[model samples]
Target: MDSISFQQYICNLDPTSLPRVVKICSGVYFQGSVYEILGSECCLSTGDLMKIVDVQLQKVTCENMENGHMFDLPQDFKGLFQPIPETPGGTQKKPFSLNPFSTQSKTAEFCGRLYSLQEVLRSAAVRQKRLSCLEIGRSEFQLYPVYKVKAIMHFRNGVVKIDSTLDVEVVDVTEESRDVYFIKPLMLSEVLLSDHRLPVEAEILEAPELPIAFQSDWVSCLSKGCRVHIHSKGSSRQILASSQQGKKGACHYFLLSSSYKGTFRRCPRKFSSTTELALSLGPARKLQVVVTKDHNSSEEMPLFTVGDRLRVLSLARADNPSGMDMLVCCRDNGEEEEEEEQVRLPLFLEAGFVEDLRDNKKYTLSEVVQELQLPCEVKVVPKDAADPLGSVSILRLEAQIKEHCLLVSLANEPSLAFEIPPKWMDVPLFFTEGSEKPSPPTSCSKVEELSEAFYYHLLKLLPSNVPPPPRPPKRRDSKLNNCPEKPGERKTSAAEISKPPFRESKSQESAKTGARQDSLRYPNQYTIQYGPQRPPKPTKPCFQVTGTSASDDSDHDYEELCEEVQKTVHKLQRASIKH
Candidate 1:
């Protein structure tokens, strides 16, 4: 070696001593130490000491030695440690020597190669690889990248699929739109936070905080990445059983829907069923008496009165009992018996039971009698008779025979029955013209005519019942005289004419006196006057005083003179009469 420097020799050393001799390489200083190493700022000896052997050095220069291997050297010593030829004719380069002084470099190089090999083996083992069936559990399984699973479906066995591919068919698709339910999903992480199994308790936190979303499919993944799947073969049949049990309990109250049952509870039976039966009991049975006439002979009979007993026997068959067959005894007194003959009579028949008659149907008297069972013989008693005044004739047994012949005739022919009796019907009487005096009965053909007149007079006696006729003129003669001014005209003042003096001729006065005397003699006779005449003047008498002195009686005489003066003045008024 041609003067090999210690720094050059150290630069050719390997990095196996890097761990133990890095401090020594830093402390040593050699020539050409100012040249920079590629990775570190330490001298060339320090870089060589830190270098790894199996990790090929980058951006480094090398020198040659007698061996065939190349030795790493400092980039600044490129000209000095050039490779030496092995032989003159041979093309082999000589390898650099291992310096005895660079023991730390070789040791550093060996430890670096061992650390790099360990890092490479660790990276190779971590690469992704597909798992075999043995690596997974004893069951067949799928490995999803990123640990993300969408849904799961469990079969009848304990086996499950990650995403099931079965198609669902519905019997009636229209029911899906008509009946729908709202579904909500929950995640495993959210369930852990709440730690509450009850639905009411979980509602305290809002549904959005539960990390769920709505989906139309049967299988879905919840918001927190939890898988939710519908397993058709699983043991979820308990839900249907609970729903059916709830419906069975609700069927016991079916009586609430019936309309007929509701009405029966609200209404009474009497108002609903038998209303016509209650209205049929109207008037009761009694005795009645009346006068009769022969239909063929047209003859009248005497009046019947009270205390008479009438037997009303039904002519009905024995098998049917239409009404009760009873005898009625009359109890009217003498005055009532007299009234019975005078009063208008009513047609009487045996009363029948109403139940036998159909509604709105007419039945004959014989038919009704046949329905009610009664004795063939009936008795009718007059009020004045001793033996209970009853009928003994066979005519009374007939069902349709008239109770009273006159009454039945009157009911049929009212015009004939109202005929006036001879004495009681009419009589002549007098009445004043304007007075409210009752008029005596006048002759009329019928009793009804007289009764009408009696009612008219009775109406007049009651002031409130009758209106008054117009008043007659006061002066009858003045009306005949054709005077322009009416007689008895109202005077302006009473003082103007203190007395109404009459002006009559001597002959007229004498005739009037004679008529007055005649009216006094016969009070029943009425006097009649013909024409107009003035009223008579009142007379005053002349008195004489006897055996009195003429001078002493002079004042009395003066009063007589004044009286005579008044007479003279009135006498003048009589002479001025226009008539």
Candidate 2:
């Protein structure tokens, strides 16, 4: 019989109830334990019993058995697979070697021929018992083998919800094993849910259009031509905006939310705001007057004396009473808008003779008033009235009369004004009535002659110690020109006839004595010498003495006489001298 048939038979019979002698393909083996029975059929030792079936199954499959065949089992098969050494008597057994055929060369040879008919049966049965599991669709739950239906159904209702209970065996044909199992379903849900129904395609309604109501309040008013509009509420009270023109005026309108406002007001004429008043009234024009001296007419004359009373009248009032009143009162006319009025009093000259007259031709009335030292008030009594009227009336009446007002009435006419003529009353004068007359001035000719004679006499009386006047060189022909020559007389050279040696010697001696005396008196003291002492010698003697005087022994006396002679010669000398 074939190995498949034998394996079928062995599988049909239960191992526990098997008879002692069993017929396999090759021989009948005595059955003891399951291991012994399997080992004996495979021709292997009991030690390798579990693997014997596997080795035999491989051999049978590889041969693709045609019919029952006889095979030789190698000798020493028992020695080939010696019993694996036991672990410590009570400990768990060690895992057997996976290469059951390579247990030993002897065991391999012997078991190599035996067929694995029982292994094929056992594998086929195990395979048949395996259940498969598959993942189907979106739910992600797994389908178990049909054998685990009860457990799966229980898990669906949550009765049997153990994590590991679906341990059904599954055979994977692709991998040749029964290994994996499937788990029950896991479900997920959304975090939050609402009961209200949601709309799918409702039309969006436009909000009702709001009417823009512009609000404004009067914060402040702007004058004409203002570009800024004031707002009632904002950070700043005013703001700038586009200009708006209306029948009333031009103005600006601003939004309420603006923060800035204009504060400056425009001037009508910014550049010409300030104007300058008149700076110049032109150069001042001076007043002119003519003054003359007076000599006759005592009553008409200016009666002046020291400490005499005097008064003055303004001639500006001579034309009319109003004029006279204006002059007397000295009221200012307020005609100019920007100019101030200057008040002034009329002037008068006191009763006094002329002390002095200034030669000023361009003297003004004001200057005359100042020069005359005139009083402001003068009492005048009409010839009819004895009592004195006020000064003002007197001045007014005097201005009307148009006649010269008497400045003073003195006991006597002052001598200072005696030279003034009576006709020149208009000519003002300052005088001294009681002042003494000044002495007369001497004649110029008489003074000159007196001075000349006095100086001549002084020169004559001067001491002999006085220095002599310097002399110039004489010409060679001077003597010849002045005197006539005798027929036999020889003309002497000017150098030979210059001076007598004796006289020069005496003059030198006198000079030496005077110098010695000066040195003796001053003695070793330092004296400053300033100019040249001596002049160059003259070409000729300047003088020719006509007569000799006695007492010539003393050198000083000779020097004195020589000086006198030199003076006389100077007097007679020609006027023309080279300066």
Candidate 3:
């Protein structure tokens, strides 16, 4: 039996100096409790670092410090454990967290999840059994120990309190605690005010004019972990009625119509969808318009301005039996399906239609003709054949033309027409009586004959001869003349070769060969004849002496004497010339 405090036991036991067979001692005192010393200390407190010294049948010997004493411990005892320094504030470490998400232990959470000692041991035992089975016959079976344990409760506030002998607490909140959302003209994020259900209350911090597509549909909102969908704006009355009808504190929302139904509690965190721009044409037609605006619009509400022209399928006022105002409408997007959809405005917006033209005035068919200054009975061509790549088709329709452009009513769609250019019209359209069989127009033959004649005339205009290929440029004089003339041809003399080529190869070769033969035949002859020696004698006098000693002290004072000598010599020479 032993009785010792956890602190004293830890202080006396050296965990790091554990040996294969640890020397366990029976202790009589441990925090005023008497207990028999077992193998190893299995139950470990938080911030108490220890090591397993030895293992026996269902028992272990453990030491707390590298130089401390060892104590026998049972194998079943388990608790949270971590290293605590031996200095002041040694017990500052908190207990290991079972949350699995928090960074509480080094080796325990190495798998990126929290693991308890008991669970770890259990998993190890399971793995050992699985491995034994695999060694026998179940080789295909694999063992994957699960490290994350499901938590009974999750607190988003990130503060956890624990009660035990250690009384540990964990607080982990790294990022800002507030939630942020963005609302744009294209899309918006809303928050749910209640639980999961349809017709729930939601709040858009600052609501903007929503797109027309959002009309008559349910929208989902998520707040924290709860989700809700709503059919209409949450009014106080509807919210009250919903609360009364359903759970008291359930999802709060206003129901636009009891007929509405939706199956979304918590929608995904993000929802992205494009909104189409629509313009109301008349009482019936809605046209899609391509919107060109900044991705991040500055205005709270996106709106169309004046002087914008939207393109749409061609329409004429005459075609409309009601004779309503007509305007060309275009959509901002080019999606194929969207082209067919019309814009629907809310009831409050009295101006249901948005004018596509810069000027507010609407023109009738007659007015359009007058404005364009078009003449009646103009050729009309197919729209497809208007471009250069488009081949002219045989079919032709002529209604009225203006500035080489024609507008002909479409047969299938009377309300719409094809705007054609003059070039698109196939030449020489022939109209035959209904009774007579249709055939190629006779004018086509004439056109062919005329084209042939024009082509032949163009050919005649071109010059008959290409003016013989320009003679190749004459070769310029170059060093190719370095090669001697042909064997039989008159050979150039040394004068010619040396004068032009500078050093003649023939002369250089002869001099080199002769010098080489002389050196080889008389190896030491030249050296001996021109040995390293001074000349035997000088043919000319060293100086014009005029009777002076070879070594004279007067040399130092010769400048004065030399001057007088020069004067007398000059006088003698002048006299001699006179004589």
Candidate 4:
């Protein structure tokens, strides 16, 4: 292609059209600098002037014409991404108003977002009583808080760029209540447009959205105790702690959620810088004063003291009331809930039974012991437990008792008594101090000497009249004889034994005749009688039989006789047969 067509092709070619073009080629300058284009290569060299000597199908090589050195380049090179130039309004010579109400916005692309040009200009505007200028190299230019947006530039590679204002604010130099000025507020100056080092979305690296005023629970500096709320250039969930203090004596700190844990640094140039995180400076607190004029009016004096706390009626009214109004009852309602739940439980007012720890038995209280029993549920408090006083939780069984609550220290030789509230009885009690129960008296005399008195008293509640049920003696190394180990010798061997003839015994013959006579005389009517009896021993081998008959035989002995006769005949037949 001719030079004209080649230039046209380069202009029409979109670098970002190819998603594979991720790495960016270096040597492209943001300032006015010329780049060399060879036959098939585009040489990008960082210098005032560079001369291209060779070109390849996929590679571009160039030598620094100023230094006269051969250039070594890599393949798959891409053009650099530069920031778009300012819009027409930025280049105009007209002075813009500092008033915020006069701000206007024109639709334009900023940080890849479609923003109004006038809105960005207004954001970049800073109001100050005195003018400030910035020095870059040898050139000096007046600074403005905000600048007008001129245009949006779209590169062939899908990268977009725009000129936006950097946000700044003024803050107090000291914690004192006097109006003092140490430095001028940050002012907006020239527009900064630069190419990113890598191929990345410009919008992604832009500063976060910032609130107008920074808020916090409380921010404390490590070096000083002064608490200050810092605003953000852009809203970010990152808390910034400066290693170095600002021009003013105050250290800049911003509030962020507890979730964020990262380092924060201010960006020196454009707020869109990728390496630097953009943040807003805190605003100065202004107090309105009513100046009284003298006859000359040369010097006006304010009536209010500088140190007085300034409160906005709107804010004061909103916050003057204590936060306690927003709080629910801080006192625990657990006691009320406990009372309701305890109502379902049964009262233990009946004759009390003492659990014998030694025997692991419970015995009923005898009348003698019951007569002396106090109307209280006594629980033994073990030693070395949570209760230092070694007190037991006692609930009075008798409502008539003046002292409904009592404490008997288990640790003492003589149990001591501490009075607790009767309300404690409505719930499962713990000996914690407070509420109706105060801390147990520190001194021993403060408590009654009921110590082991109640312990023994409770032991007295056990029935001394009723004897304990007897238990069988434990057999040592005793096991039931399941089977005999010895084998008995047979009376006769198989060859010597003779087989007996099958014959019915006289008892069986008589039983058959009786059954036949009974069946003929009367129909059988069986009546079953059953009752509980002690289990039989292993050796006794007792069993039961039940049946229905139309006979009048109710005698237990007659039934046993019938069963015995049947067994005898079966045994005889078995003995007659050969083994």
Q: lDDT of each prediction vs. the true structure? A: 0.24, 0.23, 0.26, 0.24
Name the better of 1 and 3 by TM-score: 3
TM-scores of all candidate predictions against the true structure: 0.10, 0.09, 0.13, 0.12
Highest lDDT: give the candidate number: 3
Candidates 1 and 4, the one with greater TM-score: 4
Q: Tens digits of per-residue lDDT for model 3 on 6-74?
A: 222222222243321111222322222322122211222222221223211233334423344445434
lDDT of 2 by residue, 1-579 (tens): 122222333223333332212122222332332212212222211211110111111121111023323242222122111112223453322212212232322222322332222332333222122111121111211111111111121012121211111221111121221232222221101101212121111111121122211111211111122122101111211111122243464332222111111111111110100000001001232111111222222331232223321111122222332111111111113244544332222122111221121232432223323332221121222223321111112110001001111111111222111110111111211122233433322211100011233223433443443224223223335432555566876555333444467455788999999889754432322111112334544644233333444343433454465566666556545443633
lDDT of 1 by residue, 145-233 (tens): 11111111111111111111111111112122232221233332333333442112111111222111111121121122221111011
User: What is the C-alpha lDDT profile of model 4 across 119-172, one tens digit per residue?
Assistant: 322232211111111211222122122111111111112122111111111111
Clashes of each: 24, 18, 41, 33
Worst 10 residues of 4 by lDDT: 273-282
lDDT of 2: 0.23
lDDT of 4 at 244: 17
